[model samples]
Target: MIALSRKHRTALAMIGFLCLMTGSGCDYRKEFQFSGPTMGTTYHITIKAPFWNSMTSLDRSIREELAAVNKSMSVYDKESEISRFNAIEDTRQSMEISERFAEVLSLSKQVWDLTEGAFDPTVFPLVRIWGFYTGNENGLPDEKTLEAIHHQVGFGYVRFDDRNHIGKCIPEISLDLGAIAKGYGVDQIAAVIRKAGYTDFLVEIGGEVVASGRKASDQPWRIGINYPDPAAPLDLVYKSLTLQNKAIATSGDYRNFRQIGGKRYAHIIDPRTGSPIDNGVVSVSVIADTCALADGLATGLMVMGHEKGIALVEGLPGTECLYLVKNAEGALQEFASSGFGKTP
Candidate 1:
């Protein structure tokens, strides 16, 4: 339920357009950029290809890929596959879903289990009750109200099978893929670019990014993690990584929060406690082989806090995390996995 300011959206939309229109070309390769709005945010893509490669066809294919993802996953779309399923009221009946929908759901389940319910798409009810969802009143709910809603929140209520049929055990249970869909969109577009025989490209949706091969300058792609300081400039970099053939997704509480009763509540809710996360951990960034995994894990890690988060990541091969936490004295501190800043 995090809201993006109009200013942030406009800045993202302009970045790729300016890069593409200016014809920023090097001696051996030309970098082509494409950008537009999607999934409640903007996406920017840059491809380093030979001078002869046609951006026209690639642009068409990339847009098609994004459209397909939005059609399947966007909750805002009343006619989307997810919305249609959410409309169903019968627990005994199951609806057949597209393969792409099943793919994202399967990944969601894995992250849900791995994080021990730290991340649950079924937490939509709690999100609504906390007034994080649009059109809801923002206030602390009574204990009775919180208890009633907790009964409706759990991934166990979601029923699905290998045949791509999905149903909820209760009519009130619903799914929201906001935490992971953008990363999945990035992965899908990266696949599209690879299918077009392009080896060097970077795909970014919102702040989730995936890098493939080196840039036209023969250097690894440099990605900056946003500094989780509300007072600082929006594009300020806390850390930079040179990435190749990897994905990074960051989730932070600094930007998305509601001030109520003279205290701030983060948009991220703990499905287990049926409450907004108030832990001092302010930001989490995950690096993984796939952006979808990174995206889900980032949110889950934020809920897990620092100690357990670091321990959980240490066991996950090819997965690393960086956590920015606030000490009791109100100072920013950093905790990272063993291989967090290492070049992959």
Candidate 2:
């Protein structure tokens, strides 16, 4: 489901996230650039190096590989394998799904189970009902209407068999991959890049960013975290860290929701309630070994809110999160996992 960001009267903003050039102390710099189309969105890559020039051919390979990934995963595309399966579930005795597709759904189930229905694919029905997937160009839904959608949302309904690459949809149920598919696709593309002997690189899909290696400039890449305020320049550097074999993802409901009836509602919905989240969190950023984990987990955190989400992140090794939310005083409060604050 696509998120619908709510605009509030309060002047608080935490906006966009960017993957930047890698290096150290603003001096070291590397020249690595790779950008190609996939997933109905262009993927941009920047790598620093002699390695960059050495692997120029890799740019084309990376793009081509990611395109293949999109074919199997995109629920939005009617011709996509997943989309076709969604359309034809009852017509055939069995539904054919791809190995990669099965893997993503399988991983999604894990998050669904771990979070106890927080990150659910079955919430697609609720998403469609609210018109986030279609009709209503405007954002936010009436509370009574959204709460009714809660009946159709559940993660346990999506059934798949990885061994045979088959998936079946329960009646009246739809699947939404807006939260995790992009990251999973990025991970697949990254795997292809590393397999082809490219080491130092960065990859971004619709603002989900991951990078590795140092820039020729010798400084860690500086990522600019946007403040939602339109008037404010993106001067605040939220992080200066090397991707250096790590993946990072940031998820926020602020970017996509709309204001309604003087209340602020997040595009991120609570599957159990089938309503837009009221979790005061502005954004949740995650760091992990793979973009897939970081991506799915970020969505999970969005659906989980602050306290429960932080508890979840704290218990997972190598998983750190920074949550931005409105405090009791209405001033912004930043809560970071132990692994996050040390970034230069």
- In terms of lDDT, the best-performing candidate is 1
Cα lDDT of model 1 by residue, 1-344, tens digit = 22347875576556657777887642546788999999999999999975545588879999998999999999999999999988989999899999999999999999999999999988988887888767665578889999999999999899999999999899988899999999999999999999888889999999999999988888899999998978879999999988899999999989877888898888899999999898899999999999999999999999999899999999999999999999889899999999998975
For model 2, what is the error of residue 229's alpha carbon versus the real structure, in angstroms, after optimal superposition? 4.8
User: What's the true lDDT of residue 87 in model 1?
Assistant: 90
Clashing pairs in 1: none
Model 1 residue runs over 4 Å out of place are 1-26, 135-138
TM-score of 2: 0.81
Model 2, 177-244: lDDT tens digits are: 76888888778777876776556667788767777665556556555455543234545444444555
Q: What is the TM-score of each candidate against the true structure?
A: 0.91, 0.81
Provide the lowest-lDDT 10-residue window in model 2. Answer: 9-18
Best by TM-score: 1
